[model samples]
Target: TGYGDDHTREIMRQELRERLIQAEREGRPLRVYCGYDPRTTDLHLGHTITMHKLRQFQEFGHHVIFLIGSFTSLIGDPDDVKAREILTPEKVAENAQTYKEQAFKILDPKKTEVRHNSEWLAELGFLDVIKLAQHFTVQQFLAREGFSNRLEDGNPIYLHEFFYPLMQGYDPIGLKADAQVGGQDQLFNLMAGRQLMQKLGVQPQVVIAMGESLPGTDGIEKMSKSKGNHIALLSEPGQMYTSLMKLPDFAMPLYFKLLLGWSQEDVDDMMVRINRGEVEPQEVKAGMALDITTIFHGREAALQGREFSRKAMQEGGIPDDIAEHVILSDTPLVDLLVVTGLCKSKGDAKRQIQGGGVRRDSDKVTDFDEIVRVTDLPTVLQY
Candidate 1:
């Protein structure tokens, strides 16, 4: 499975070199796994960091299990969040069906072993749960970042929330995973797997922690669908492409490094170019968009995205393939723009003109007070 071209070999060599030193000290390729809960209906860019880590393991000839958190998702994995919202089993299963297909966009399906925790977690009896819980103490659970934050802030900490780690820890033991992959936010739970495996007399799984999460278009919190900041995995290629284009210039290089699989050296070089102002930020963002779209779509689609972006930007119009708002009438330009869902508010639309951010058919708008006469232009003007 590790056999590939020169670049793949180099990537494998680098990752394996780092991982081997942290392994069980034998010469065998270690089993590596990462788990994902079917909380949201679609995977976002945030989900792919761990998926990329799993891909790295696959490239290094290690056994990789892409575990689905069907069982624990029902209880809700409240590790980083303040509250856990319950999900029905059917909803979780239905959501899981799309996950593997989305994951296959980046991961090698043949090298991945897909398993659902419900297959084992659901069959556990009262005594089984007790045995699993025996490995950790209340103090230990409370000490975790999520629980600790909630407790300190007077948020409700449900009893079921404590079972999340116990169930997750049981996964490595069940699969005999040599390493568990998780984002930095999941460090507490990932470490719990080590403790639980040691307590259960199984080999402790080594932890490969992913970097901090990518924020959404809003560029504040983690990219989540509920926050309206996420670019959904299942979004149209053009939409996903445009969303990447919207990221602030500062976030572009990080996206390239963590999401686009660029080498650290390449990322550092880009940073240097950026600091020198030798490369405009939009060029970097365009490169990131191309790389990411190429992963989900292909070279042709990524090129199409670039071309579409060029046309949209040059003409001050939305991409042709993107959903178009057919204005029933030639509405007022400002109203038409806001109705198209481009501007956040009427005030924002006005501000854009006042702040020189608004453009009208390739012409910069200088007057926010000017009433857009439908008769002036028969077609609607878009942002």
Candidate 2:
């Protein structure tokens, strides 16, 4: 969510209001779009912020384009300090396969028009690119934060990286979009679209830049898959619930607002109650976890996830439905941990054991070389 100041936000709001009236008079739905680059195989909760905005448009009978950045993903977004590794067309295609399925978890599939940017971007010839490039100056590109930061740090900014914004800007031209939604970090790119539309003699699209960024589980950095702080849309219900429950109490209000769409006033009231000792933060967090989990995994699964969390964390007991692994003979504890998916590897199991995090039947396993015999088959293991 990147609307810089209150004045700008107010202007955008007014413009949108007028545009809505104009569209209604024309008896046509406003064409709104948001693009997503399938850089990863799965979309995380952070990716859904703009999606939720798109859903609102769909609900209002507006036309929504779920544009996939098939061409742009090649260079990646130049929002990073350093140039991103280029992805092959094959890799980008593979990742794009599941994007729509995951997106449908939040979006109404019937109301959404899915398009790949490659349809238009790949058709642009060299002459077309040159004509597009004429609209912006090198100084303007250099003025962007990512490019400027890299320049100051003496980092190499690839010439191709400059073309990313141009390609993205051309999207609105191709789609004739009325409005675009994106994260605040994408403000510059969204502005590029508006500027390009004006120069090309087309009506500029309204930019609905989201002003809030979801913090990761760390409750500090923005939620990112690369940072290992993301909760993936495809995550198991129990895993998703546990991950949200791990967030710091300070991060709960934002999560409630962004994920649950709670109003600022409601979030403030909830925080006041928590501060006044009217309710336990854990209880509130549990409710949030359950509600959010229910969004993706259904109510029954979310309830089961809550039960699993309560058993493992609060009650210090295992869920009755926890996976059972039958062992016919004694096995190395480290080996068992890996086989049962308790640890990533033997080294991870050993480290967990060394840290006194590995437990059997509620007793901490201090030895890395400990064995799990047939006698311990019925015992519960906790990490």
Candidate 3:
């Protein structure tokens, strides 16, 4: 659960310890929550950080709420460098639809309580909003890096941007949350929750921070859908393998630590081996890819993904990052290949098939005339 830099990690650990002590004294289970703004349909690997922490809380017996930020998502997170387009209620609903189902991939549904902030936030009148706003001064919002940077650079800092933290703060008070899990950037917003709860004569929620924004597939900025640098949770096993395998070698230590929970000694040994040419980085990445694929897709599919990838590497014809094209059942192999643009023509597809250069996963495609089914999706085409 402590998944950040040393500084943030220590702070979160201490907070958790103190919160546990407080809960013991109070003689009740803590109400734990992690709010997710459903800005998009599918969550990437990074978004799961806090969800994992929430799952941890659920495992040992605590009230866990999967708070969907339906209203707050409309505010577009002032923490982002650029303002996000305001989404309509219908759009937000659509985006939120799959969040719980996906989150259940990590959280225990039987123990998890799902709530939409719209249930409360949407009900707030102007006067009620003003009352909430009175809790924080404009200077407080200005202190946030996102807002402050925008203001200093002469970028537009919409007056409504200040309300994001306020609304999020109200979430804990409404739920009487004893602890909250979120990304490091959200600690400030959670602080608002604490402040407001204290003002309202309720105990403040313990803030348990996680990721410092996971590195994207690009290995630069945080993994984000808008940036096209994220690996979606619903990605097929093969696709997931492809994305993990493409991460920069330098990004491995963090990925291993944060995503796979590798120890420092393990990471150091891996780096040392790579530096000494004791093992190829590609091989190490393959293991990591298989491990990750196994997590979401299970061992059998992971093995198949590994075999599919290894075959592609051996063939030297299939590019690792080809865009996927969905093909239906009973589709002729030649037709599918040509449709995918992997072959210049049916003739080319046939030639490749005849030469045994075409493959479907681990098997060589022996017949161009062979029909494919829905089960044959995520096929690897070699020249």
Clashing pairs in 1: none
- Once fitted onto the true fold, the runs of candidate 3 whose alpha carbons sit more than 4 angstroms away are 1-15, 25-27, 79-81, 311-319, 325-374, 380-383
- Residue ranges of candidate 1 with Cα displaced over 4 Å: 1-28, 79-82, 309-383
**Candidate with better lDDT, 2 vs 3:** 2
For 1-383, candidate 2 gives per-residue lDDT tens digits of 23477887788898899999999999999999999998888789988899999999999899999999999888888855788889998999999998998889999999999999999999999999999999988998888888988999999999999999999999999998999999888888888998999998998999899999999989989998878889888776666788888899999988999999999999999999999999999999999999999999899878876765555556536653455455668998889899989999999999999999988867899988888886543455777
TM-score of each: 0.75, 0.83, 0.82
Candidate 1 lDDT, tens digit per residue, 90-208? 98998888888888877899988899989888999999999888878999888776778889988889888898889888888878787788876776677778789888788677766
lDDT of 3 by residue, 1-383 (tens): 22235775676668778888888898988899999898888788888777777877888888899999999999767754667678898999999887888788788999999999998999999999988888899888887888788888888887777888899999997787888888887778877898888878887777777645679998888888878999887777777887889899988887887777788899999999999999999999989989878877789988877766565656655665656554435788789888878799998888888888887755788975688776765576544
What is the model-wide C-alpha lDDT for candidate 3?
0.81
Residue 285, candidate 3: C-alpha displacement in angstroms: 1.2
Models ranked on lDDT = 2, 3, 1
* Structural RMSD, model 2: 6.9
The candidate that wins on lDDT is: 2
